[model samples]
Target: MELRCKVFLRYCTCFAVIGALLVWPAPVHSAVVVIGARPYLERVAKRVVEILEGRYISGNSLPIADYVAPIQLTDKGLSITGNVSFHSAFLAKIDSIEFDAQKFSEIFLNTEVTVQGALKWHGIGVVLDFAANLEEYNGTGTLYVTYNQFDFPLKVTKPFNSTEPTGSLQFMSIDNSNKIVTVGYPNNKYVQLISRAIMTNFDFRDYMIASFRNWNFQNLLKAVIDEVPFPEVCYNC
Candidate 1:
């Protein structure tokens, strides 16, 4: 089942080249991200999730895809902070993951919600990026077994290339139970003012760093199911 690199490349070539979709001038002093209306937020969130999920789930059969979450904001009021977890979900167990779980397993998506990111504007609409570490995702059910696991991290680069709004995230230091995924913002004055000019733009300077001070062994559970490893793959086998 190991796909040769050339074959993989040819097969994967069938899919579109993936990247962000935004282009824009540098930050303007008067530009402030305003939270869109509730309905707008819902629509934008759905579109964003679909873009990401589409790429991961069907585009190329990525290791993890098909993201699911609730439909409400976690906070009481409109979020204009740093980031907000607008939705959430709980699966029966983490051990049930396969390369094509969405095509097979019956996964349940939760409708819980949370928020934190600034409700900034990107010309097209409101934006909130949650560049944080995930907490324990314990599995719970009456007609099932018992398990404990944490949700995996799925970082989003700025939407399409229309804004040219580019940012980078990197895994910084790690502690006992946590790991900090630093999202650096080079051009945002708000981020610079907050981080004291500590973050490096593409370097993930001080943009957004989700700290993980304690990491469980399960957090590192990555399954490599490929009989052949390559940058791309063809499934004509």
Candidate 2:
């Protein structure tokens, strides 16, 4: 009888432990609830912009350095070669950013970028070889270059076991009005000459687009998204 009582007590204790375990509250993870495609994408875009504002955008300038490789283009049987470089450069301002999400995996981004800094160029043409320098701080020679309709294609990937999504943004295209707005008096004639050469021979739009595309924000985006709780399964997104 004693042995039977001991076994019965042991069984009761195990049952009590199991019951407690079953009633214990488990840790709950929050998730994002994607309702509509556009709304969800807008949320993502806002988050992305917030990240950009924190990392790239500071006060009124975006610190950057851009370069254009030596370009060779022929015009009217004239060989033209040149390279443009932007040093101590900074994006003056971002007029606007528009994000169009085609689907959960693809997005099209468009923005207008204004950059200011020291602009240097070297050009060799059939008639003459010239070089120029334009600095933002130079009171006599400051130029405002605008890259309009800067378009980029973004590919989003959701890795296995990762709730957050990462994006790869690539340079798709850019259109420049080819109008260099001179803000100050001209101090160097070579600046104008090289600017004209760059406008005519080299595609400065491509250079700007390539430079912006090189800024990889995949990890930054993922980290930001991870912090925000989204539904594990987005039915609409």
Candidate 3:
């Protein structure tokens, strides 16, 4: 009878162990991001640029609330005479500048990549003293659009903000299979200045541009990027 009791207790212990194993959660294994991280990132950047270009189609106008004159003119009367005007005036749209994906430079893994494009502000200008019209501005003859930073919400296991590259790939994990990617405005001063300068120099040179300085180009770019669908990339099957 004692031997039977011992066997029964051993069976009960085995059942208990099996039951615990069944109830416990399995260990989480990190996901592997396929290679081709750089190409994927560049594609994402190009899509963002396309969205921005589309957002400001020719004829669509936006308000210039804080339009400031780049040069200090005390007594000279300034006026904007275009499809768009200034100082709470309308900002007339021009032709979309083509984004050159070939020149996408300073690529930092999946962190950032800069685009080269030209902004031609034709028929858009300020009339000084209601006399001389200044109607053109160019940055390196081509605007340098840098996709300042990117984030991976669906692909990354954890929230990450570091720009530094990691591992043999030399870039952050970019799941080619993932469908979504996040892009943010650049924090770089040169980029900010150039963006603002473009607006001030040709788009809104006559009005108090400083008053409308809150109109952030970065936010505009981010909004534009958000509207476009994330580009898809496939590699290694």
Candidate 4:
């Protein structure tokens, strides 16, 4: 009877310990924002700039250095600038060929971009670069893509299309407070390049417009998201 009582007591103690363990609250980890995120986003932004440089200014395009200046993070997204220069060799080529009854050679393209929207994960269905409504985006920018280093700032409106190749119809936002980012693209958009130079017979408008089309903002946003180490649960995101 004594042995049986001791065994029964041990079983009771084990049950009590197990019950306590089950009822214990799990530890919570707070979401990290602005402080730990900015530098990472900046690095991503620089990489994006490099990719754009490769697409627009490399190889047979231009031998000059494509400069992507520093970026500024905003409430909805971020803003960035780049210096696109045409080297003397490119200029000489342009001078050699007569495009529109003019000697077209040395040029500088200074562009400003403002990207706004949010990043959302729509479960496991096609996780990369999902599309939100066009109305949800506020992505837009100005183009100083011109000749002889002329600063012709053209307002770029939304609804970017491959046909028009002037304005873009994409919206993206970066919310560090909520620890979330998003991108929205229109199925079809007329990216209007409203410029006085176009009316003044700027023969390079088409080339400038084409270059604008090559700047893929979506890739940039993707790079930024990929760089950050978000928690698996993403309770805050």
| Model 1 misplaced stretches (Cα beyond 4 Å) | 1-42, 52-55, 58-60, 64-163, 167-237
Candidate 3 colliding pairs: 66-209, 66-212, 67-207, 67-208, 67-209, 68-208, 68-209
Candidate 4: Cα lDDT at 184: 20
Q: How close is every model to the real structure, measured as TM-score?
A: 0.17, 0.51, 0.29, 0.24
- Tens-place lDDT per residue, model 3, 118-202, is 2222222211111122332221211222222222111111112433222110112211212221221243333234334333344
Ranked candidates, highest TM-score first? 2, 3, 4, 1
**Model 3, which residues run further than 4 Å from truth?**
1-38, 53-62, 66-86, 107-237
Q: In candidate 1, how many Å is residue 38 off? A: 6.9
The sequence of per-residue lDDT tens digits that candidate 1 reaches over residues 115-158 is 11111111111112223222312221111112222232222122
Lowest summed lDDT across 10 adjacent residues in model 4 is found at 91-100
Scored against the true structure, residue 8 in model 4 reaches a CA lDDT of 100
In every candidate, how many clashes are there? Answer: 50, 6, 7, 16
Arranged by lDDT with the best first, the candidates are 2, 3, 4, 1
In candidate 2 the C-alpha lDDT for residue 60 amounts to 25
- Strongest candidate by lDDT: 2
lDDT for each residue of candidate 2 in 1-237, tens digit (9 for 90 to 100): 999999999999999999998999877775433334345445656666676656655442332444544544554554434454444445655555656554233222232111111111111011111222233221223344554455555444444355555545544555554543322125454444444544554455445445555655667657655664443343233
